[model samples]
Target: MNGEDELEELDEESLHDSEALPAERPNPLIIAASVTARGGVLWLPVAGLLALSGKKKAAGRALTAAAVAMPIGHLVSLVVHRPRPQAANIPARQALPEHPDSSSFPSKHAVTAAAFGTATALEDRKAAILVTPLVLLVAYSRLRTRVHWPTDVLGGLVIGALVALAQAGIGRSARARATACRLFAMVRPVLSDHSCPSSVSE
Candidate 1:
């Protein structure tokens, strides 16, 4: 099949995304060597350190977002039980790892990376900058590792955004409480004066 046609089929994960490498190259050796060569490895431990650094509330929120999103993605994986692309006649970029092999419809790593990114962004904009690319790389690594299709990574991205939004919404409620209190203070006296009964005007 031509490259474009191969991309369209679920047949190539049309549900999540298209995770194809360059159609020009096909060497397992090269794919393996380059897969983990980028920021993917470094970001995981750094994110872990950020998580374990005793920032309990933020960390809890982050973990919760990740916890919720990943299971949802995994549920998608379990129900679909989509075979690893490698098993389904696609050319796997690298040999599959022996451990933790199962359904890969949605990437957990991508979900966690996104959760981490969203949590960090709540505190530091620069940290968020560092996180965005790492999340993308982590997704790419899965493709090179030969266990998933591109759509799986894409699915993770969509799910991750949802997780981030949910986490943000919880925080938004907290902020609204404080904001409303401040806002009310400014208009409270006027409200009290206006609220006086009309008979008092005598």
Candidate 2:
């Protein structure tokens, strides 16, 4: 075929392929995933509730784990500055309603979910089972929304798990416990309920 005719044929094929692809639209799964991603906000309060419920040691570990992991995730995202799956030429719906202003190498949502669940598991395994599935769901949501690649979510999960484990270890150290006691004491009076525990204890 002549050059012009070949170009025209290729254009037609391209048009057909585009037409065959489904149009992007919101769905129940995507919506639910978005809600699950609010994991960041949801888990912190859960830790607080645990403290209020008198599970202070579990709450302290969970809170500490989350605090440590989230900042690491943010810093990693900044350092790596990787593009989102959609930006990387991967086919995805880009379904998230609002996009974050950081790199997609380690998904913040996945990190928070993993850190929370893992930390909770260290405190109480039964509770972890309930949390683990939710964390996995949030990770999957990052993939489904095209905000992250599989590896990105994996990296986030690893980082979060490691941080939680590290926190648990440190919590067991006498020096760390002393520091924690001082920290807790300083903050307890500021609590409106004045019911916040003054030390991490099982």
Candidate 3:
């Protein structure tokens, strides 16, 4: 081919290649999910609403669960040095431009989601049903955004659930103790009255 012909051909090929490459467009759904997955974003408002509605126990549990889950997730990430999906050369898109350069195993977002969901469930099943979809979406977003592996999400879920369960168990135990004390207090007064009357009659 002549020089001009060759130049034309190269230009055409470049145009074709550029057209073939897909542009990286921002996904609004993924972005929304990622934002919603934040521990504070989901839990804080829910807790506040619950408190305003006089559901203090549910609010307390949800906040406590998220608080407890965060440290545990951080501790696990420290112990397990796993790379994020993108760092591992996996084909994935990150929803956020900035992310922590820490171990990807056991996603903190997932942990917080699970902990808040489970604690809410323990307090109010109906509220949990509404919250469950959000939790699942948060977990899926972590994977979709290439921030966490499936195992990381799973491990976080397990940790969160366990923490919520432990908290619920403790609450139940405390309630049982309180109930026993209340019953004893009521019965003790009755017994004292009977004994005094009997002693006076004797």
Candidate 4:
């Protein structure tokens, strides 16, 4: 009935309310997806496999697009300064294993994955089929883990696709071929150590 007694009762009610909220559980698939999105680890093997399969040109183009997308997306994120879902007080079912130090406007993971998938698809439709699903999964994972908002992934997708389109268009040009030749020449010493096919130069 007194003020102290009333305050104690209120505190108990608040504690009960807080305890009623469900705790977030971790999903194995989501954990794997989150890890895959980090540092372009998933795409490295994909690119390496393409190179090993003698589609080095295609691999190069895809990787080039991914490389381009990463910095562009990061710059955009810096300008946008949009907080991630958690930072914005938007609840995520799960959190990243290690939080990123960057802003989360456009998901770099989505951008790189999308760019890689789109570029690979441009070179080989069959490989795209495999890559596209993985890209989508990475996008979905960002949402599921609450690292990015829907629009963040969408922005990344758009940028990535555009970069891939540009790379594919350039890949068809004589200038790009010349550039590739020059690039290959610069790395010839490294290539000499490997069994690079003669056709890759041609």
TM-score of 3: 0.74
lDDT over C-alpha atoms for residue 175 of model 3: 78
Cα lDDT of model 4 overall?
0.73
- Alpha-carbon lDDT, every model: 0.59, 0.68, 0.73, 0.73
For candidate 1, the per-residue lDDT at 170 reads 73
**How do the residues 14-130 of candidate 3 rate in per-residue lDDT, one tens digit apiece?**
212133321232357765777766655777887788788777888889889889888899999999998765432323354365576899878898899899989999999877877
TM-scores of the candidates in the order shown = 0.60, 0.65, 0.74, 0.69
Candidate order by TM-score, decreasing, is: 3, 4, 2, 1
Cα misplacement distance, residue 123 of candidate 1 (Å):
4.0
Model 2 — which ten-residue stretch has the worst lDDT?
14-23
lDDT by residue (18-104, candidate 2, tens digit) is 433222443567547656556377676677777776777776777678777888899998899876543323233544556565687
Worst 10 residues of 3 by lDDT: 14-23
Q: Which candidate has the highest TM-score of all?
A: 3
Runs of candidate 1 with Cα error greater than 4 angstroms are: 1-44, 48-61, 87-96, 99-101, 178-202
RMSD of each: 8.5, 12.5, 14.2, 13.8
What TM-score does candidate 1 reach? 0.60
